[model samples]
Target: MSFDQYHEPVNELSDETRTFARMIVSLTEEAEAINWYEQRISVEKDKQAKAIMQNAQHEEFKHFGMDLEFLLRKKTVWRETLKAILFQNGDIVELGKEGEEASE
Candidate 1:
């Protein structure tokens, strides 16, 4: 209901840009859900409740990954940068710097 995600006028933006913004919001919401579930699971007294929260968290994680993949598919430089940094065994900061350079 809230159109708070857009910094520009909605009428001025293309459909693709609007969809991209919506997905960005979705990604953020999924991340927040994951975090909330993590916090709940950490302090939950009931094992069953914790298990349910964990399951829900897993779903959120999947959504987050999917949303990220969608956005990455839309941006070539972002995809290239992440490829340089992700799944690599090295200093993260260094890898990030390398990724930035590689993308350029």
Candidate 2:
């Protein structure tokens, strides 16, 4: 089997590092699926088909969120930064800037 996600030699990396790389790749794939569904839904002519795509997109969103939370749990700094940036409404860039400072 191909471990395309690994930039470093698989034998040289720790098990934890390998797992992290796998999850990172999983998260990227989920994000791409969500984007693909979005584009397909936009051009879809049938209302029923569009609704089905929307439902599938929601599943992808959940997968992406779960993957993100998993990664965040592993990286404390990222968790800290996103805790500041997520769930609040207002200038996102400003919040991110504040989060980057807060995480340090």
TM-scores, all models, native as reference:
0.96, 0.94
CA-lDDT, candidates in order:
0.95, 0.95
lDDT of 1: 0.95
User: Which residue ranges in model 1 land beyond 4 Å of their true spot?
Assistant: none
Candidate 1 TM-score over all chains jointly: 0.96
lDDT of 2 by residue, 1-104 (tens): 55789887888999999989989999999999999999999999999999999999999999999999999999999999998899989899999999999999
Q: Please list the Cα RMSD from the true structure of every candidate, rounded to 1 decimal place.
A: 1.1, 1.1
Candidate 1, which ten residues in sequence have the lowest lDDT sum? Answer: 1-10
Query: How would you encode candidate 1's per-residue C-alpha lDDT over 1-104 as one tens digit per residue?
Result: 34999999899899999999999999999999999999999999999999999999999999999999999999999999999999999999999999999999
Model 2, TM vs. native: 0.94
Clashing pairs counted in every model: 0, 0
Model 2 weakest lDDT span, ten residues long: 1-10
